[model samples]
Target chain A: MELELESEGGELVVPVELLYGITEELTVTVVLPFRDPFENGRLGSVGLRAKWRFATRFSPGRADAVAAVGGITVPRSSADGPQAGPVIIAGLAAGRESRRWYYFAGVRTAIHLADEGNDPGEQLLLNVAWGVRPWLTEYLAPDLVLLVEASSRTEGRTRVNGQTVDASGGEVLSVAPAFLLSYRNVMLKGGVQIPVWEHLNDAGRSEDVRILAALELHW
Target chain B: MNRTLFVLLAGFAFGVTPAAAQDAQRDSTEQVAPAAHPDIVMRVDGLACPFCAHGLERKLDALEATETVEIRLNEGLVLLYLRDEHSVSDQALTKAVTDAGFVVRAIERHPPTEGTD
Candidate 1:
């Protein structure tokens, strides 16, 4: 679930996701995010994500992995906006994990597949996160991990009927801090994103804060 | 709202210490090779939570030889049960765990003990 307050309005999202590991090298996930912007509630979008691990290096105390992620997001409701259809996303992620700390970096981009005379904003995403776990134990204890991340998004211009409507789409950055807690097959994570910088065209809303909470059940 | 988030961050900063880490490494040598219906135990690092450990389970379960996979979070151990007529090498175990984003400190193979299904 996510709650975001922006200069224009507020939005809430409840997303259900199904993830499966097809093999040691491949994984797939499907997500359906329910969205509510103010009084109207509707299906936001459907998305599919696939990740392929290309390289992994392991040692006694540390491990590093590199993977490529590809996905597609399709808007489900007209409330989405013009230039809304299927957007293909691709990215590469690299991470290092140890007993105490984990860090990851990734970059992603959304390429719009829209009809003629409709221009939707393409999105670019870059993110880096670092997390640390305290209290390594020999018995059953709830594991807790604290994380901090920097996320940046760059949006292109929006055009309607082949005409530019909002040119103020550029870049926005946020600093998010989060925590994870888990016992066995269940995990919970919560965080808040605070805007740190912006260089945008007039088309995008300035966000106040983004609150997030997620739960995962693994078999 | 920002203050609330900052307070949450500070709360975490003061909550725990790194001294609680589970860093026990077992000796892999002197262990017998796995028999039919093998039971494999491995010590792992970076298994801080169930979500992270789930990756290891998924990878191990994908093998045709694996019948079941179990993770003991606190002990940082993964146990795999193999079907009869199939076996997994230590190198394969290491690669699978590493690909799942964790490190294997040691791996041991054993015959299925009595009462262990």
Candidate 2:
């Protein structure tokens, strides 16, 4: 579940994801999003994602490792129907994991679809995160991971109703502090995204705070 | 003859005969042996998230002769216990880990345990 609060209104999102591992290097994911209740709640968007891990290295005796990751997201959310035009999202992620620490960096972009709201602008995203396990145990007690991340999303100019709208796109930077707990095969994660900076055009929308919480299960 | 008779009487009181005791010992001896159920332990990379760990577990469990799959997140260890008459190769283990989006660092074969039931 996710929620974003802005000057205009608030949005609530519930997303369901199904992922399968096809090969050692490839994975496929399907995502279906349920719309916000306050904003005419309905089926929002359906997305298909694929990721390939092309490189990896592990230490012989320790829990230290690194990997290179690449993936793409194909979105089907347009004004025409639920599964019409496609929006392309491509990104690269790299990360390292050790006994007590985790770090990651990623860059991605989203190409907007036609007739998707009033905005048809491209979005560029960059994110970096660092996480640490404060308490480590092998018992049934869940491991607690504290994470801090900084993310920036910048949007290009938009075309609304066939006319270019210069003021309809902007940039927002946010810092999120999150926590994850793993119990058995279930992981629970929650965080709040606080905007640190914003650069908006005259008519661009501004956001205040956004919150995210997700539950993952492994079969 | 008297000692043997007394021992047999004692065994009957305790719910065990000489032949039954030998069978029990043999059954236990077969448990921790490699011919029973073999266990494989692998040190894995990127067993960080529960999601990924779960995926690896599913893959390993799907393999033949797999009795149980256990993941030690803190240690980044994947343990697979195979039933009797089942075995997995090193390549299969590596492929399972990689398919689940992880890397295999090291693999070790441990003697089967007595408590796999």
Candidate 3:
């Protein structure tokens, strides 16, 4: 998936992670995250994941079946912005592999707690991934994947810093194009997330380009 | 008749040139020494997919055990080249990778290959 520790400008914004699933399928995941966007303070939270693996029942090869995952962000974190809580979300995902090609798709809706009395915290997100690992030889291989996702957001009228502005925001559309190139087990992942479209009352200064990079190793 | 003679001489020169070059290369290859580093093979669990593979490598980098790292995805194992083997042991290496979020299935001496020291 295309995730980022959202860093725009050079402000003290909480680093956002489009990151998830540090563990394998059908297992519980524990995420201890600290920080919130614009809070300038440490916000701590945890999560749990349960995969369904449904497609496993009918796969001809080593299919991962299907998965249903649900988790909640505790109220202790920021009660505002993208890291809203107490939030709950459930997702249904399915994946399959045919030789060199690996495919996956999932849809999720997060019910975040109310914010600014207008509910800018409630949203729904859907994402999909396709990857190809071409094995050139016994000691060399390359992995490539693409992801597409969209989210619906709610923004209430409010004032930031000190501007009495009527920020009647609604829904926003986002798209991310990601690429991962791997040499054997060591991989380099990079992606760019752009704001496609959104029903914003006033998307102050509009959004800017965001990016991320990470190195992964497999044994 | 002159063109044919020239062609024959050219063919003869080309054939002898490759043989002479091959003889010299073989002599140099035979004189080179083997590598000095040993192989570290580690079998691990919780490494069944791409996401974990990424995170596992990040975790392994945190250890700073040796310099170079080689991961075998299909074989579900990792190999490192350490200057001194004591810097990381079987159990210690397993715990580091696991703490970064992976399971250690096996740890053993990698069978030496022809050029390893």
Reference-based TM-score of each model: 0.70, 0.70, 0.48
TM-score of 2: 0.70
Per-residue error at B1 for model 3, in Å? 78
Strongest candidate by DockQ: 1
A9-107, model 3: which lDDT tens digit per residue?
Answer: 543223223334434434554444434333555645555445544434322212354778887766553422443336687888777643356677777
- Of the pair 2 and 3, which is ahead by TM-score? 2
Q: Report iRMS (Å) of candidate 1.
A: 7.4
Poorest stretch of ten by lDDT in candidate 1 chain B: B21-30
Give the per-residue lDDT of model 3 (tens digit) for B1-117. Answer: 435533543443233334335433543542353135435677765444443354555465456555445565566667666544335656667666756555676666645432222
What is candidate 1's lDDT per residue for A1-219, written digit by digit as tens?
A: 122222224666667688887876698988876666335757667889999989977654466889999999877647566445688999999998766787999999998876656667889999999999876642234678889999999988877677776664688899999987764445667888888998877634565788777665555
What TM value does model 3 have? 0.48
lDDT of 2 by residue, A38-85 (tens): 456565566777777666665632233333443444444451243323
Model 3 alpha-carbon miss at residue A88, Å: 1.0
By TM-score: ranked, best first = 2, 1, 3
